[model samples]
Target: MWLYSEIRTLGDIPRHYSRITPAAPALIGADGPVSWSQLDIRSNQIANVVAAADVVPGARVALLGKNSTRYFEILFGVNKIGVALLPLNWRLALPELVAILQDASPDLFFADREYADVAEKAIASSGLRCRVIGYDSTRPGRSALDELMSAASSDDQVVDVNPWHTAILMYTSGTTGKPKGVQLSHQSYLYLRLCEHLEPSFSYTSEDVMLTVMPLFHAMGVGLSLQALYNGAAVAVYSMPDPGKLLALIQHDRPTLLPLIPTVIQMMLDHPDAATADLSSVRVVVYAGSPIGLSPLKRALQAMTCDFIQFYGATETCAGVTFLRPDQHRRGIKLESCGSPLPLVELKVADSDGNEVPDGQVGEFLLRSPSLTTGYHNQPDFTAHAFRDGWYHTGDAGYRDADGFFYIVDRVKDMIITGGENVYSTEVEQALQQISGVQLCAAIGLPDAKWGERVVAVVVPEPNAVLVAEQLIAQCRELIAGYKVPKEIVFVSSLPITASGKVMKSVLRDEIIAQTSR
Candidate 1:
């Protein structure tokens, strides 16, 4: 009922910026940047291209690409006209991608030229209208990204959609199974952004330069980019994630704020250049998407003198409904916890029968927030299951301490029930990451006959790293409960990880099943 319609689109940013700080750099593409007026003008051009294509308001337009400035422009354009933007996963196989496309049934599909072949096959298989454009479109029919800015209108406003109307329908990365489209309303989007806005540290002042390494499709990226631009913060976007390049960008831009995945942070800590990197200007480093192991968490602290705040949330809940501030993390409390609730969010831990658990008991995490997704697209039954009794069941099992700090045990679906005892995968994975030879590790519950499910760890060793399962088990036995340790360790060259850098344990479970069966 309030006026968050004010932050509804890219157009909102220009007027806000012009009034607050006109010359502030609003967007920094890999090539360079544009002022607030330029970003809005650029989005307007993309909107014209969308209009010329005969796309009607309320039409569904699909975008298949990585993190690019053009992609954000397209997002603004499509949403400005009250059309829903669907961004397909670039990593999905063509067959699976085709299935998703069939579901959305988009009016027009734009394939990033980098993924031209895959996108072509995906669109071709689907019976949807489509075209291919170079991410850096220079040729005719290529529909260069710049063309949208030049060939189209510089319109200021389009008909606004209802706050309850859908904007972007982002599908889950589907690490476990088929991706489901998460339906985010314009208001819910604003609510999530407002949670961050509530923070006393937030500012649109010209002094704040934001460095973003997360993908544009991610909830964190979408939330940060829009709100930051609206507030007039200059944002430098990395089209693709690279440990070295990200550090260099931070050094060059001297970003005042950075919200990123733990893996990116760990990589930055590991980079040799970080020792000499010009990070004197960093004030806050917001880390999330996945929990950090204790070792990497410690290293990340030592690597940067910036205040670190770790947030935990999901696409379903916009972003951080809970945050562990730097002060709490440094005070030797909530080390494995994701922190307490944000201003507008509510959290509860519930059991199998949908009963809320005691404060100290581990159970599924559930949420009821103004920012939670409206529902999964076209999946009423799934939505009913997800949004139960006004609470969105997180499918994650965690407990709250007497002081109300939350601790994540593991995903309820990922818990191993070996010998009738529940085991949290993160507990073992954390222990495994500490072993000298272990470079990377993932723990998953594999189907088993003796035990309903057994804990299995897939590990990638460091160069010249060597370790036997027995040695690792002996090490784990001393540190954690025996039931919590992996029953077997399978050495892998690498892990299947999502763009946000969380280890895809569900993928690992499949490998574990095939190997165990044989």
Candidate 2:
């Protein structure tokens, strides 16, 4: 745990590892294993490149890519010069990406080869004059990141980066239909690791290998990967989540730590190779991002025969608030609970009036932690609304039992978490309204076996207007990300409305479920 105590900032992680365990494997990807020394040297070169470009402290740099060695290098390099790294979600559509770029206004942009075209288009549309740096593949107008790093100095670049400075600027779907950038500081990550060190449950060892399949844009992917690297463990990075390739990687790399969602868990278990795949190397399987059904939890436990830990939190909290330890994951033993607050976390369930609720009563979850984000970038109004009286107001509804175990019942904000992605119903409903044929529409999440919840649009067609489900779905696809698109469209004559003329999504969701079951 010397490394945990020594690292004061995110930039120090690579520097400490380079000296203590230079020859140890830090990352394992398709390009092969990269040692701690190599990682440190490469990150230094990256820092020198950005510094030479005259980017100053508190400036923003962006990376639009998947999970790769380049992503980590960019993350550390950007942090080295006291600049924040804004990781863009690759799955977002062009307009969505354009809006984010315009809002953030990063000084430089790094794009993976696969997203070169879209990245260029977003910059042009946003009218930003930032330089486009390419990785993996190069375009005619862009400079390759590898070539720049190769020619830059390997000497560590020192900048006055404080623990309060923003390290990562992550965007989450907003209720107002625009994404809000969550500003996470160096302490947001380092303090979480320190808390883990103090408590010592589900700890990582130097010999462990982490299988990282989640997207780098997410808090879970970045948080877990940094955790492994901080402990001198190796991370096996996959480009994306593919059940077949994941099964093969488990056999080859024999990763000791695995983190995933319920959807991926079911996919891997249903794969043809899962029955014969060797998953013995996995010591602990951690799941979060969304609620997992009791049935699927039991099925996964029976199939993998490894320790399972479920933690609950969001991007705003740096993703580690409560944890269901492996020892507590048994039948009739708080399986439905998301477990207790972490060592450094303070949690309370509050009602709408901001009053604390009694035990076993559902209310909004409010938490205070060192890992909590300072605020949303450039959105002071939003920050003021969510953070009050030294506590971050989580719009999630949950309850704590007499034994201190917390159970999440629902999301008070009406945010639909499908396949680990947060999809705001209001955002989808706004898109639906753009279509002429949609007179009235409400988006709600329904329980699904594959995805934790499937987005469903219950719509009332315009009078005498001809509309088809397939056509509406196609139109909706152009307005939002594919993941936010509703999987099914139900045409109803009328939608139940409240006295205030607001669509009652709860009643609609219940009705849809009853109709579907029939």
TM-score of each: 0.77, 0.97
- In the predicted model 2, the residue pairs found to clash are none
Q: What is the C-alpha RMSD of each candidate to the true structure, in Å?
A: 10.5, 2.0
lDDT, candidate 2, 359-434, per-residue tens: 9999999999888998998899899989987778999999999999999999898999999888999989998999
Worst 10 residues of 1 by lDDT: 133-142
Give candidate 1 regions above 4 Å deviation.
1-5, 9-11, 18-20, 131-134, 137-145, 173-176, 200-206, 415-518
lDDT of all predictions: 0.72, 0.88
Q: What TM-score would you give candidate 2 relative to the actual structure?
A: 0.97
Clashes of 1: 1
Whole-model alpha-carbon lDDT for candidate 2: 0.88
Residues 431-503, model 1: lDDT tens digits: 7887899999888877554344678888999999788999998887755556667888899898989999988
User: Model 2 off-target regions past 4 Å?
Assistant: 2-5, 137-143, 330-332
